[model samples]
Target: MPKLKLDIASKVLRLANPLRVAGYTFETWEVIVVTLDDGARRGRGEASGIYFLGDDAANMRAAIEDVRAAVEGGLDREALRSLLPPGGARNAIDCALWELEAARSGKPVWQLAGVPQPRPVVTTFTLSADTPIEMARGAVGYVDARAIKIKLTGDLALDLQRVHAIRAARPDVWLGVDGNQGFVRDQLDALIPALVEQRVSLLEQPLARGEEAALEGLASPIPIAGDESIVSLADVTAAPSQFQIVNIKLDKCGGLTEGLLMAAEARRLGLGVMVGTMIGTSLATAPGFVLAQLCDFVDLDGATFIVEDRLPSVAYRDGTVFAGPDVWGSGRP
Candidate 1:
């Protein structure tokens, strides 16, 4: 371990357009960028905390400063978990360590993480919750999309109308619904049937975070993915009862280190694993993109939602996303 100089900067990344999800509307995302400099080599990481959880960039910056001494003292990812509880602060630092190690070891992040040779992963493009006509038009607009996820706002009739309109518009793409913790237990009974009828494949976080118990014995044909409900490694163990799939977001779980553990734990519990991201630039999505290789499903289009993305960024082509060595986890400055 070597002593390192740590630098932190906060940035506000403007969204390409207003994004309306279940519990919030976003015009921009505030992200924290952490850089680790070990003289000749440098590693950088970016993180935007879970906004719904009140994990914003200001708090993340303060959190990192609190542990600045330990980080500069050659802190490793394993020790970082105890220093900073899972959130944006830990996520940014943890990812920075991964990139640093990759640079030092002369290996790519996927290689360091023991993943097979990387491949472009097909991901779901999400449609912001809106009126039926606009939502349908949005679906039609994604000409290259092979899979689409619809954001629902817990309104039964209106949500149904929106779903049906999109389904009618793009019958060819695989469909998934993200309630963003906007639906209740009873509503899911009706909603699941309608979603199934519309050929929807995945249902994500239909209920609120503390309401996981409500889904304990509920049965459904659609695979329910735990997003807000599963934040850290502990949450992954408990997710199987409520969710068929666990969505791993680096910022939410802290970083790639915990993310890998969560994925393994979810698999051990026989739950499917998916990778997702918040509305941030390529830096925020790159670590998640590396973790995406092990996922059963991927939602790495966070960078696509931003107005402008980082250079040498991750690329989306033919409905799949990929990050070469230069984008992240390659130890490039």
Candidate 2:
């Protein structure tokens, strides 16, 4: 790898609507974008900082700066893992390395990642927590979506109402619900039945982080996914004990490299894998799109909620999403 010019910046992405969930309501998101240029080749990456862990855009930039000399001095991706903790800063730089390799090798990222031929994959469109009627209407708004993920607070009755309304409105689509770590043991036990009634196939992060033990011996008909509970490859061991599925986001796991490793680990443990995202643009979503090929479930609709997205964006067509090579993977330089 040649000594590369590194450029870092942040973008404030406004949501099309207020994204209301269990513990947070997001109207705007700040993402860090990284670009690596080596005279003839360019690579780009984006990351939605780990806000829960206080890894905001400012810190993400600072993290990059902390290791600026080593990076421009030709620090490789594997060494990068040690340079920065698994978070937005590492995710951005790691992905940029992947893309840079793609450009240098004249291969698309999928091929670089060992996927021969990648295809568009169906993804779940999400509806934020809202009144039952409003959420139902939101479901109808995703005209081409074949799958839907509904955000739910711990309010058992209201959550049930929202699911029932959406199910009634679109009985044809696959359904799932995210508690965002809003429920306790008893509350989740109470909510599972209602979700099953609505044909909800997955329950995501019902219990708060570190509460995976409470789920022991509790079997759910719907596969429970560990999102907030599992952060990166280090947290994969905790999944088999508490969840049937592990949700991998590049921002959370740090990058596509760890995301792929986490998926492989989940498979080895006989746990399912899902590719999810924070609210971001196509640049951020594209790397996750590559990782989705190995996943059982996909939820890469983060850009769909944003008011303005970059051109050459990921396309949501006929209920599936695809990002052409032009998006960010290769041919940029």
Candidate 3:
């Protein structure tokens, strides 16, 4: 086995504006980047830990450092699954391994994974949780976007008002809402109907993870997606009973290898898949974009919130994400 060199670093990206999600607000995106060198080739990966989920840059870096010996001794992606629990650290290392293999074999990561060619993906632009007027103003900027995802914080009246305002602003764009596990089960009855009236196409994680059983046999006006509820293959198996769609984030699942398997399994179980991401640079969104190819909804808009992105960035024109050949794992020669 060839000895591999590992490098880990952290960066804080200033957000273009304060981003308010269901539980917290952040003005900066803290990311952990990993690079591996085999003396002949180099591979790179990035991870933006889910802050609300108790993941942060420092801890992710420490996790990577914990596996220094294993990585240097030639850790492969499959071995990595057992070595590290699913989260930012595993995501970074798993993606790095894929990049390393692609560089070594002179093949794209998609080819190595037996995935079809990737094309420009149409993605959703998000409106951070805010007042109805403010969210409407945000929606105005994304008029050209095919779909817009609105963040809600469980305020039944305010959340409905925000959705209605955004719909009034951009009636032509499809609308989706992510409650981020902020809503209570009782609110869904009133909220879902109001959202449906405004033509909201999707509702994501309206209730908390453990509270998902409340959705069983409940008829919802809008299709619901499971974000917090489904993090692993086993979660995917249980998701169909609670949700019509499963939101798969690479950071949540660990990496592209597992994400791909999860998406495949979700489809086999007749659940729609949505590829999402934690706020980071194009490096983080690129791997999610690959997974987006197999998804019914694409939410890789994390880069849109950052004021600056890493070089060889993924490009967004209107709502389409274009991955260039210069980027890692782009699967382009």
lDDT at 99 for candidate 2? 93
Candidate 1: where are CA atoms >4 Å away? 331-333
Q: Tens-digit lDDT track for model 1 on 186-300?
A: 8987999999999999999999999999999888999999999999998987887889999999989999999999999998999999999998888888888888889999999
Error of 2 at 99 (Å): 0.8
TM-score per model over all chains: 0.98, 0.98, 0.97
**TM-score: model 2 vs. ground truth:** 0.98
Rank candidates, TM-score, best first. 1, 2, 3
What value does the lDDT take at residue 112 in candidate 1? 90
Of candidates 3 and 1, the better by TM-score:
1
Candidate 3 has its poorest 10 consecutive residues by lDDT at 324-333
> Per-model C-alpha lDDT, please?
0.91, 0.91, 0.88
Give the winner by TM-score: 2 or 3. 2
lDDT of 3 by residue, 211-246 (tens): 989999989868899988888777898887899998
Q: Compared with the true structure, what per-residue lDDT tens digits does model 2 show for residues 289-324?
A: 999999899999999989999998999999999988
Candidate 3, residue 90: how far the Cα is off, in Å: 0.2
Pairs of residues clashing in candidate 3: none
* Candidate 1, backbone clash total: 1
